[model samples]
Structure formats: structure tokens, C-alpha cells
Target: MPRAEFDKPVKVLIVASPYYKDISDNQIAGAVAELDAVGAGHDIVHVPGALEIPTAIGIAERLSNFDGYVALGCVIRGETTHYDTVCNDSSRALQLLGLQGLCIGNGILTVENYAQAAVRADPKDQNKGGGAAAAALHLIALTRKWGNSGQSVGFASDILLAGGKTTA
Candidate 1:
């Protein structure tokens, strides 16, 4: 993982879900505190549940000034299969957004029981929210590096750079 660029000013948006209000709130707080420590500017947004985080992040990506996004939510399994759908779909959605060059911090917790969820929600334990924020910040740094190096434009050691012509 790359170090946090504490010297640079970065803007982050955190979206928390209210489904598992207790756990989600804890995660969001963890994210906020961690980002604050890194000297980054941030905003907190609330949504209905895990399902809504991806869309909120999508909107954030369209902003020209926002540097990154953090999605925090907790989904505890129940007797029904609803948990699987929410967890899987939300994870894939956020991953897709990130792959498209959207800096996303995914903190969605999908666990089989309350105990499992509690472990992650605890500030001292996994604290996945904090981890996610760090990841987003790191990715932002990498994006800046790649953008500056011009490596993101094209391959350097390839014949394609010859304007579709080969030396005779």
C-alpha cells in the first residue's frame, strides 16, 4: 500500500447506510476519524442501506472536484437470502465503479451473525471502514502518479507508437 499524501489536499465523500444503523454508524465514524487524521477534507452522506451506496458513489464520481469516495454499511445475515443479494450486488457495483477509475473505499460488511459484524464495526478490530478510506486515499495518490507520468496514455515500448507504420 502507498503512504498517505498528507501534504496534498484531497476531498472525500463518505456514504453510510441506515439498515444496520448501529454498525453502519460505527463504521462511518471510523472512516471519518481516520480521514480527518490524514488531513483530508470530507463530507458524510446518509442513504437508506447498503443497496444505495453504489449509486451515491456514482454521483460523487461525476463531480470534478471530489477526489474519492468511501462507502460504509453493515449487512447481517438473516434466515432469508436477501443478505446475499445485497452484499454481492453492492460489492460488485462498487468494484465496477472503482475499475472505471473512480476512487472508491468499500466498507460494506456482510456477516453471518451480529458477533461477526460487531468485530468489524469495533474501532480497534478490523475497522474495515478505516481500511477502506486508507485504500481510497492511496489509490488517489497512484492515480496522480500515473496521470503525471503519462503512462496512462499508452504503452511506451510498442510498435503502435509508430503511427501504424513499420520501418522498411
Candidate 2:
């Protein structure tokens, strides 16, 4: 996997849901290792479940100065429809936040069973947690590439004024 290189160390926040303690621990381990390898500093914050991961990151984004966020959790299918609700809603929330220009990586696992969750969360296996961290780093790199130009899309102020149009 291609990774972004940085001359200065970046800071990241890992928001994890510890509903499944062992699984969450493993995922956290993988994410931490990846951040360490890239010399990025990180801090971990635990929430109750998958749905809370994005909320925590949103709070941190407003209150802290993290360069990016890694969201980690596991949602296993159960006998009820609650599973679907949790999976879809959590994913959607993360996607929405990303669209709003927040650098967030969704690592929450939505699987049919515990076995499937284990394999994906394991650092020695798919290492999805680490992959999430990498995703956030890549986004941070892109944000840095653009810097803060404060330019907006659409017609320039002068053009809008000429047409007797105003932007409110």
C-alpha cells in the first residue's frame, strides 16, 4: 500500500468502540502500530459502540487539533434488525463527515459473524485497522497539499456584482 511521507510528524485521534473488548483491542493495536511506523502521534478515545465512533471524532474535531481520525469498531449480525440499523447509520455518518472536509477513516467492521470480524480485525490478517490509519494519513496529505487558499467555487465576487446578484 502506498503511504504519504511527511517531514513533520502528524497527530491523529483513534476513536474506538469497545463493545467487543478483545476485538477492539486488536484493532487498536494494529492502528497504533501503523501510526508509530509513520512517526505520527496518536491518542485513543473509547466510546460505547460503533454508532458513537463518529460522534466522538466529531467532538474531537471541534475541540482538538488532530490532523485526522481513525474510527474502529465491530458490528456483527444478530437475530434482530438492529444490526442493520447500526451498520448503515454509522457508515453514513462517517461518510457525511468526510464529505464536509473532515479527514476521517472508517474502520468499523460490519460482518455476519464473530469469526469474520476476528479475521479482519487481526493485525496479522487483513489488518483493517492499520488500513484505516493509512487512509486518514493519505487524506491529511491531500489536505496539506492544498493548504488554506480560502478560494470558493463559482463566480467571482466582481462577476456576481456586475450581474446585480448577491451571495448571502
Could you estimate the TM-score for every candidate? 0.85, 0.88
Q: Determine which window of 10 residues in candidate 2 has minimal summed lDDT.
A: 153-162
- Model 2 C-alpha lDDT versus the unseen true structure: 0.92
Write model 1 residue lDDT over 70-109, tens digit each, in one string: 8898888889989899999999999999889988888888
Regions of model 2 farther than 4 Å from truth: 148-168
The numbered model that scores best in TM-score is 2
lDDT of 2 by residue, 46-142 (tens): 9999999889988998999999999999999999999999999999999999999999888999999999999999999999999999999999988
Candidate 2 lDDT score at position 19? 97
Instruction: Judging by lDDT against the true structure, name the best candidate.
Output: 2
